[model samples]
Structure formats: C-alpha cells, structure tokens
Target: MESMNESNLTALAAFNHNEALTKIPTFLFLVLLTPFGIIGNAGVIYVYGCRLKKTNLQHFITLLAVFDIVCCLVAFPLKMVELWLPVMYPSGNLCKVQNSIICFTCVASALTLLIISVDRYKKVCRPTQSQMTLCHAKILFSVITVISLIYSVTAAFIYDRRSIPLDSDGYLVGYTCVMDFNSVVTQGYFLALFVVLVIVLGTMLVLYCLVWKEAKKHFMQSDLRYRHSENQEDGEDHTSPHKRNLHRTNRTVVLISLLFAISFVPSLLVSVLFAQFTHVQFSMTTRTIRELIYGTWALNSSMNPLVYGFCNENFRTEFQNLRIPFGCYGRYPAPKKNDIKSIAQV
Candidate 1:
C-alpha cells in the first residue's frame, strides 16, 4: 500500500484488496468446470423437463434445472472470462453484468428449493391441504422471476470494472472487476440478501420438521398394519407396494435435503459476513477455503440429477430407458403416462 492522490489511492486500494484472491485455485477450478456444468445441467433439464407432464413438483424441479442452466450458460461463463482475461476495461462493465446474473440465478434457486420443500411438507404432513396445481406453480415462478430480477438489479448499480492507477502521476495500467462496496446502497442491498437467506433457511427448517414428524407417524401406522397383517400370512414380506414407494420417496427426499444443507449453508453464512464485514483481512488460504466451500453451490446444480438417479427408483428406471446413441441399447420398458406422473408426484 502506498500513499497517492485521493482518486489513485482509492482505485489502487481496491485493486490490491482483491489481488490476494487471485492466488486461490478454487475459483479457477470452478471456472474450468463451466463447460461441464452447462452440458450436464442442460442434459438434466432435457431429460426431466421434456418427458414430465405439467405438475407442480415437476415444474419446480424443471425450474431448478433451468436456474442451473442459466448459471452454467450465462453466469459461470462470464466469470470464467473475467478470471482468464489479463486486463479488463472499466468500460466493459464486467462486474455488474456478471454478478447480476449470479445474484439472479443463486437467489432464484434458493427460493425454488424452499418452494419444493414447502410442497413436500404439504403433501406429507397436511394431505388435507389444497394441492399445488400447475397454475399455482406458474404464478410462483412468475413472482420469483420478478423478485430475482428486481433484487439482482442492485448488482448492476454496485459493481464495476474498476481501473487501477499505477503511480503518483496516475499512469493508466490494468483494471479489475470488483464490487463498489463504498456505496451505501451496495451494503444495504447485501443486508437485504442476508435477510432473504434467513427467511429461506427458516422455512426449510420448519418444513423439514413437519415432514419428519409426519414420516414418523406414518411409519408407526405402517408398522402396526404390517404386524396385524402378518398373523394372516406365514413368512410373507409384509411391506406393501405403496409403502415401498413412499419409503423410496422419503429416502430420496432425505438425501437431497442433506445435500442442500451441506451446499448452501456455508455460502449463505459467507454472504452475510461479506455484507457486514467488508474490510476483513484476506489470506490466500482463507479465501481459498471460502471459495471451495461456496463453490459447492455450483457443484450442487450438476449433482442434483445424479443424486436423483442414484437415490430414486423411478429416476433409475427412466435413466435406463434413455435412448442410447446409434440405438445400441436393447429393449426398454416404456413407462406408462400414469407411471411417470406417479413418480413425479413422489
């Protein structure tokens, strides 16, 4: 750090502030995965979105894939270019444009996950409650779209491709994309985002508790039924088909929920820290750890389809039926429309 003209000092301070961050490899690793995530998440959207009929759950899942697609295609690539370029011009508006997409996709995905959990809670714990319809899903989607757009609009105002001056004479040199945290508006915007995270996480926690309680009650009733029916049949597997389906669905949901918590909690916490403590010291190792933890969000997007396929029976069945290139696959079971809908509902 060196003393210089006010304007030069301001820009140089910002440059060196983020300079140590470049030493972190986690950011670059994600940059490299941009292509893989785009391809994989797009494939997920195609497989799930194209075949599934209009249903609330399917709509929400498809929306998740869509958000992941946008992040991989739009946000991640922009970030990749920013990291790769040796020098960016302030005129390019890199930070604002790229971060705007980041804010939109990340917040939209979080809200969508909250919606999915709420839908599940309703179905599991409050079966008498009115079911979510396709139209309702559409309205929810529209609201989130508008909300994310409005929230992310702040990014465009708060970030910039800042030019760094080299010497006291203010010779032009290189520039970097950074958030203009000096603005009161930027801090306020981030504080708002922190509140949003708290609300989403709280909703998820409440829904999870309700679902768990309902699952326990169902398990007890199912055990009683099985015990009562066992006296009629000798050495029969008392588990019914419907119970098996519910068990499978519950297992899948539990796995996804655990993964969601693993991926997003750290990111949300770091975001709050950034909002409240912008001037905190940064080391290569510390920032690297943060990047690695937060990068789970990106990994989660592509991992979702795989998690579903591995944990859910229906997804495995559908995946097996997926057409192979050049028709190398043998005969496949074509699930009936009702069967697919049942799986989607699960």
Candidate 2:
C-alpha cells in the first residue's frame, strides 16, 4: 500500500510540474486580501459581539466572523511563505502544523457559516418555535470546538513526508517534506470532510431558499394590506400609519437576503468545484480555469464588509462614522459614545 501510494504521488508531482506557475500571483493577491479580510471580519466580530444585544444568533455570527478571521490569518501567511520561499523550506513538523491549522480554521469557518444560515432561517421563518436559546448557543460552540480539535489532531497525525528525490533527474530529487495525501487515512479524512461540508451547506441553502420564499410571501401580504388601507383612506379620508414601517421591513429582508446570496454563493461554488476537481489531471487551460474559479473565492472575504454595510443600517452608519487612523486615505468620523462603549467591552 505504501509503495503504491508513493508511485501515485510521484506521478502526480510529475504531472503538476509542467503546469503554469501559481506561486507569485497567488501570493501577491493573498497579501492584498489579508487586510481586507481582517478589517471586514473584525468589524463583523465587533458588531455582533459587542454592539448588538446579546442573543444566541448574534453570538454564533460573531464566532463565525472570528473563525473567518482565523482562517485568513492561518492560511494566508503559509500561502505567502509557500509562494516565495522554497517549497521545502519549512520543516516537516512546521508544515504539518501549518496545514492542520489551515484545515481546522477553514472547516470551522464553513461549519460556523452553516450554523449562521440555520440560525437565521429559524429566526426568520420559525421565530416562535425556534430552539435557539443561550444554552443552544453554548452547545453549538462546544460542538464546533470539539470538531475543530479533532480535525486538527487527525490532520497532524495523517500528514508527513516519507522520502524526497535528490535532483531534477529521474534518478533522485532532494528530500523535502510534503503531505502524503495518497494514504488511505488522509484521503478518507478529506473525503469525509468534504462530504460533510457539502451536506451541511446544501441543507442550509435549501432552508434559506424556503425562508426567502416565505418572507417574500409575507412581504407581499403586507404590501397588499397597505394598498388596501390606502384605497380605503382615499375613499374615507383616513391614512395608514403602518404602511411605511412594513415597506421598510420588507426592504430590509430583501436586502439582507441579496447580500447573503451575493457574498456567500461564489465561495460555496468554488469550494464544491475544488473538492470535485482538484485531483483531476486537467489540461493547462482547465487548470487555469480552476485557478480563476478558486481566486474568486477570495472576493467573498473582501466583499463581506460591503455586504454588511449595504444590508445592515446600523453597520452602515457605524462604518461611516468610523475614525480613520492617521495617514489613511479615506475620511472618517469620530467614534460615537456607543462605539466607545463597544470598544471598551472588547
């Protein structure tokens, strides 16, 4: 089994050797992406963690943001190092640790997003019967923590280097540490993780679609009610006080749904594609296409802030009032008293 795995890996390495270089561009883009991710996710953490009233949903979302931040921090730096330094510069243990951190954080982020979607669906579609209490939030947190730890440990144990070639010649290449993805345990772990991610994400997507439809139906009913009231007012000399409020709420729901779809769907699609296609021995053109698709996933992190600002009025106002640090390009207002309080809480 070990010999067969080594042969497969050798073939894969040879196959990938002639592909287009990815290190430089990917690194440069990651460097540009890191600050955006940090700022956007940090703001989300702040809003949900400190500014908003304490609730299970809010806490879960805050933790999701934190998970995203961790993902960016862990994965981006290692990616940069891999791009610039020699691929074998890192020791075996360091590589294992880095890979495990990346895997753990990325999985945690995905699971947390799933949790957020489910939480939102419940609150929006089944508010009265929703079981999302503080205790539920605690349980969710514990579950995610346990899952992340287990994933990290498994990854660490499963990743290692057995041998390296001495040179570019067919005879031998220099020894370098690399993950043994050919191992049954490693492959099986990845396959299981991908399966779980797909199932959870797909379920959440379905729930969100149902929630959206129901919300839209409720919005239409509210609209009809307002129109009826307006017609009666035209006939009887009366005005409807709740008409504007209903419209505002409807707009809010639509905007939030739109933001979620736009910011999240691309990343989900990329993840699915990568899971299915990464191991395929594609032509250069196809490989390029894959890279492009994967690159768009970074947009998800960058656009998160824009989505939040557009969907949430509070975030918009707070962002506009954010005080820029010295030497920054953009104008920003001083922090509000509430912002100060939130910061203090943090």
Q: Point to the candidate with the largest lDDT.
A: 1
**CA lDDT of each prediction against the hidden true structure:** 0.69, 0.59
lDDT of 2 by residue, 205-294 (tens): 687677667766666666667668667644553323343333333343334334444534554466545555545656756555555544
What tens digits encode model 1's per-residue C-alpha lDDT throughout 308-340?
Answer: 677666766765556643322235544578877
TM per prediction: 0.79, 0.69
Which of the numbered candidates is closest to the native, going by highest TM-score? 1
The candidate 2 region of ten consecutive residues with least summed lDDT is 237-246
Query: Cα-based RMSD of the predictions, in order?
Result: 5.6, 8.0
Using alpha carbons, what is the TM-score of model 1? 0.79
lDDT of 2 at 41: 83
Instruction: Kindly give the stretch of ten consecutive residues in candidate 1 with the minimal lDDT sum.
Output: 324-333
